[model samples]
Target: MSSVRIILNFLSGFGVLANIFLLVFYTFIILCHRPKPTDMISCQLTFIHIVLLITGPDIWLWDIFESLNIDNDFKCKTTFYINRMMRSLSICITCLLGVFQAVTISPSSSLLNKFKYKLKKYMISAFLFIWSFNLPFTCHRIIYSGAFTNVSETKQMKATKFCSLFSMNHIIRALILTVATSRDVFLVGLMLATSAYMVIILFRHKRQHKHLHSLSHLKASPEKRATQTILLLVVFFVVMYWVDFIISFTAILLRMYDPVILSIQKFVMNVYPTITPLIQISSDNRIINMLKHMQSLCHHIFKWR
Candidate 1:
């Protein structure tokens, strides 16, 4: 129960609350307006985020649980299970969105134009695949996932390491790292490639048409803006992810305190999920307008009642 653990838990708890508040607002607007395809992607991402907010990383009711100073084996397994599932799914969905946006914005003559047509046609299948494909990998968490008798006063859940005592843990850790790093590297590369191509497309469009008032320019603006947002997201992901990876590897090498490593990773991972809705709000005028209308509707409804 170090001060660092307490502070990290408190911040995670706050982040969970913030995510919930913003999600409610975003959900209200989306439901009222009827979500478009891209909005549905946002909705899917947000849905995975509910698990993120309420489970893992000592975020779910952290203050309440920490004060009681108790954690169970069942709770640890369940939390980490959902954490593994949702983390995998979120990254998959994010990569999909990046690819979708890239293809959707590509010009008719571009090679990626084929993907624009196929993406919508295949999006449902893609989603289904994401769930089914990750199940096996996520289930692998069962090997070392469990609870501890020694729950610290500063923390409710002792960070469980089922493999820490085993000589075989190294082999298992290597396998886990291999699977995880391979997947991450592939997705990250896809995002970077798509982002770079999309940027090139945008610049080409601008160069071809210097006139901002042209019909093509107006049509291109929203696409470019959304793609740019995705690129920003990709940038953020790449930077934070590498930082976390390095820290995590170093922590393992040096045998750093579990709480310190947990605290660092928790803060690092939560950054994107916490702020994603705000990113959508800033980039999407449609959502903003819908929110405005929803606010007025609610105001009227309350007055009528």
Candidate 2:
């Protein structure tokens, strides 16, 4: 192992612990508040964060323990395929969240408002659609990856190896990459469009309700904050998605299977999942109120002393 990889592993190990803590925090918030109908997407986002943290960067951290008692190909393929599915699913959920919020704030007379009123009713069905859609696409990953024990190293190292089955067939490998890219592009495009539309609506509302914004700035603040929070999340997700996409394209098309490229891609992918929970807590009114109360309680106790 290189010094760089060792350092990366240590950092991600610590992040894994932090991610677990934040996962519990968000889960508790959802449980306590019983998320509102509009907030259901936020709850789903929280759960997706939990899924990604457990399966993303932690995969590398846990790879060291793989036992080659037998050819553990089954475990490797299963774990790798599941991780891919989780990563893809998280993106889909994010796009869903953007659309959900966009429709939510649309004017009552607009077509989007029609979706707004009905979206909460079909939240579970929408999630079911995401599952039914992305899960099947990731089945291709199982065909592409498997467990392999490398004998080149003195100690046997078993890891989930990708493109093992089709490494020799460049054309099929390219086709697989093309299909995955096209799917993501279409979905991400929707995310971009929705985010843009949401921004436009917010901008128009601010212009139309300037008096309301000034007279009851407190009321306007929460709505603006919520919209900004969702928009910021979509923007961050877009940056991460594009970075991963470009790296993925190079890694697949050019077969630039360098450790550095793989590590970079994995790091970018892991960063969002690990950090998203904190963002959720920041946006959550209930969680913020709880924190404020706890702060005052601690201060009062210390002051009494």
Candidate 3:
């Protein structure tokens, strides 16, 4: 395999494993304790990332499906559609996470304070709405994508090794692009606004902390840490997302898949998902505490032996 393929495979493997670990950890917490609203969101996001990685073209899911003697059109349509859906859900959930955190950290007198009471209710509603919203917008993928036959005379563009996107009429393509772009723009804009608000809130809180306590006495609260982690993830996501978007849009416009560019885009696309779980694992006190508890238990068992 080429170096690019090797790296992409490694990333897919790591992302899948990390996201699975996170999914199980979050599930354990939900079952063992009164789950926080953010816990549900994090769990859902982890699950989405796992789906995204598995269905991702770079992961060779299509090749496996082909080996299974699955119908070409069926394999291409299902894989691409699910991958697109999960990608859409990934952004929506991440944006929601940021907005949710911003509301969570709002001061008692802030306008967003009212949401604290109905956070869980709103979270569920948001999840449903996002799923409903993205499902239709990305349905175009199913219509336009099929197995790649690579006829030199055709307008089909290779989306993956086995799947290609057939050209649509200009008007239909424009409408789909507009709707998808609008959704992405709105979500990304909301993420940015929430992130900026979070930064300001953090700054104000830190200033107050300095006034009320000595530097040595100051310690970050769980909410603050969660907010910081979300902020980092959001910022990183926006960067990676736009880079992926630009490359994809360019490819679509130029009517060329350019293997090297596609490879780079895939790498960029996977970066956020790959790092997301690691960020949560490292920053989340609960995960850290759980690890410590397991370590202590192991030590006790070893000592007893």
Candidate 4:
């Protein structure tokens, strides 16, 4: 395999394993204890990313699907549709994470304070709404994506070895692009707004508390830590999202999908998901404490044996 292929495979493998580990941890917390709404959201994010990575083209899944002898056009349509839907879900859930944190940290007097009580109550409903909202928008992918039979065809954009996007009429393409772009712009804008709100809340909290205590004595609260983590994730995700979006948009506009450019775009697309679990695992004290507790338990059991 070429160096780029090797690197992509390694990254995908690492991302899948990390996400799976994080998902298992969150599942344990949910089933064994009183789960926080954020935990549930994070768990769902991990699961979506897992699907996204697996469905991603030129990865391990292509060989598996090839072995199953599925019809090439059917494979193209199903894979592209699912991948597109997962991407939509990923952004929406990430935005929801920031919004939830913003509400969680809102002061009692703040206008967002009312949402604090409803975080858990409406969590499931919000997820359902997001899924329902994004699901229809991506149905266009199913209609346009099909097997790539000819590289000489300038109108088709090859997404993978088997799957390519067939040309749509100019009017249809423009309408679909507009709808997709609008969805992304709205979600990303909302995500940034929520992150900014969280930053303001955190700043005010620090200013209010700093006067009463020494800087060393002002340990960060769990909410503050969670907010900071989500902020980092939001910033990282936005940067990655825009980079991937530009590559995709340029490809669509030019009606060309160069292999090298596609490879780079795939690399960029997976970066956020790959790094997310690492950020959460390293920064979240809850995960750290849980790890410590498990370690001690294992040591005691081994020693007793």
Candidate 5:
């Protein structure tokens, strides 16, 4: 189990480093030009990547417990708080990305289209709202475990009793678990539904294009490709989320404390944000073109343009 935890930590660390490079690359692209909706999503995902990159190192350090002495209780509390907040924020942002894509692909005549303009205007506000809504939970996390104490010297130290990530009381713990589970389920359902609707609409559009057989509609291909890209993202979300949820659920149910399971959970949770920038780069032509243009500019700049 220890060896397994070490391997998982290595993989998670690798993921964090990869995400950092991708985030910086995407940031360069965004700085060079105005970003589209997909680019905005990538920007938000980059923020998530940075958060994970910082916290992932702490988790890796936590896994190698025997090597170093973590002196401050505040460090533990801060790390715990940041990790939980970033995880929740990532989940919320991914859900927003799905809904945003759904809205982007929606037909002008569709009911969802009525709010399309509103969505565009208030997209940043929506992001802020979710972040604010999650603030209380993040703030509550700080009250949990603080500095580590040597339990061997102080045999009477009730570490688990005094310091908990969440309430240790059975009822409160159950309530917290229920709420978290339901929230995740709701977001997943919304993403799946929106993705499914987009798929159906795209299918119908393709059928129409097939029947028309008109060479004038070159734009149809791009639209179809965009829809496919979103579908792929939705699939990625569902699979990653389910895997993480299952592991977490099992640990919660069995009261298991295996470090290996914890490492796997962290890896799975961080995987989506780490891969998200790449997905945006692959799926959006605007970002790709912007990146190419930036490369051209960089070369000219170095040549003293």
Candidate 6:
């Protein structure tokens, strides 16, 4: 096997392991007890993460097979289409998670609250819309041609899969790039603005005091912890996603098409989903307390009965 093959295999294996760990952690949270709406959204994000992880390995595996001169056109096109679609869906769902959390934290008197009920009602519809909008891009995958094989190099030549644009003309490429970049920027901006609002609300809440007893309880409350967790999550997402955006933009401008850059992009994208479950678990004290209380009650009931 060539060096490229080895690297691809390594990344594929690592992604698989990371996704498995995330799945197990999410399962533990679910088995412990039912989760709140926010945690449920986080759990859904984890499921998307698992799907990405499972599909991620195939990209690398395809690269390995190509390097080793193994041709499989059917596998190439299928993997390419599935991977691209699922990855796009993952990105969309992640953005949705951020938006949902932000809305959930919005103050009751804020204008955003006026449409809060509509937001909840259209959550699934919005998700469906995202998927539908992205489906067209992936539909061209069916007509994608596998890479040409080099018969001189090896007796058993392998066909590689490359992203085939239905229209590779300058106009199409420019339009697609514009749309993708704009979408990403809009989502990132919204996320940052909402997070900033949340931080301001938290600071104001902290500065004000109710009664003495209420103040003491609030000081040691789960709400404070949840706020801290959300802040941390927002920070984590901002930093990671910014790094990815910078790298991606640089690559696009420089016209540098390297596998390493692609690999890093994939890694960063996958990390958010995997780590989301942990954030949800740590942030929600109610879930933890409920789990413990249920266990205790079960033990006592079993002993008495």
Pick by TM-score: which candidate is best? 3
lDDT of 6 at 46: 58
TM-scores of the models, in the order given? 0.79, 0.81, 0.95, 0.93, 0.77, 0.69
Tally clashing residue pairs in candidate 5: 2
Candidate 4 weakest lDDT stretch, 10 residues: 209-218
- On a 0 to 1 TM-score scale, where does candidate 5 land against the true structure? 0.77
Better of 3 and 6 by lDDT: 3
* Residue range 171-199, candidate 5, lDDT tens digits: 86677678877888898899889888988
Q: Residue 181's C-alpha lDDT in candidate 1? A: 87
After superposition, which runs of candidate 4 have C-alpha atoms over 4 Å from their true positions? 212-216, 298-305
Task: Point out the higher-scoring one by TM-score: 1 or 2.
Answer: 2
lDDT of each: 0.70, 0.70, 0.89, 0.87, 0.68, 0.62
* True-vs-predicted CA distance for residue 53, candidate 4, Å: 0.8
lDDT of 2: 0.70
Rank the models by TM-score, top first: 3, 4, 2, 1, 5, 6
Off by over 4 Å in 5: 1-14, 21-32, 57-72, 146-167, 212-223, 290-305
Candidate 2: tens digits of C-alpha lDDT, residues 128-152: 9988987887886677565554434
Residue pairs clashing, model 6: none
Q: Quick one: RMSD of model 4?
A: 1.9
Candidate 6 lDDT for residue 149: 54
Instruction: Give the Å error, residue 295, model 1.
Output: 5.9
Which residue pairs in candidate 3 have backbone atoms (N, alpha carbon, C) closer than 3 angstroms, thus clashing? Answer: none
lDDT of 6: 0.62
Model 6, 215-255: lDDT tens digits are: 46555466557656766776677788788778777665644
Q: Which residue runs does candidate 3 get wrong by more than 4 Å?
A: 213-217
lDDT of 4 by residue, 1-305 (tens): 77988898899899999999999989998999998779999999999999888888777777677899878888888888888899999999999999988888888898989988788798899999998988898998998889889868556777776778887898998898798888889989998898888888888887888777766547887778888999999989998999998898788676777788889998997888899999999988888998899999999999999
Q: Taking the tens digit of each residue's C-alpha lDDT, what string does model 1 give over 239-274?
A: 777887787777666543375676677777777777
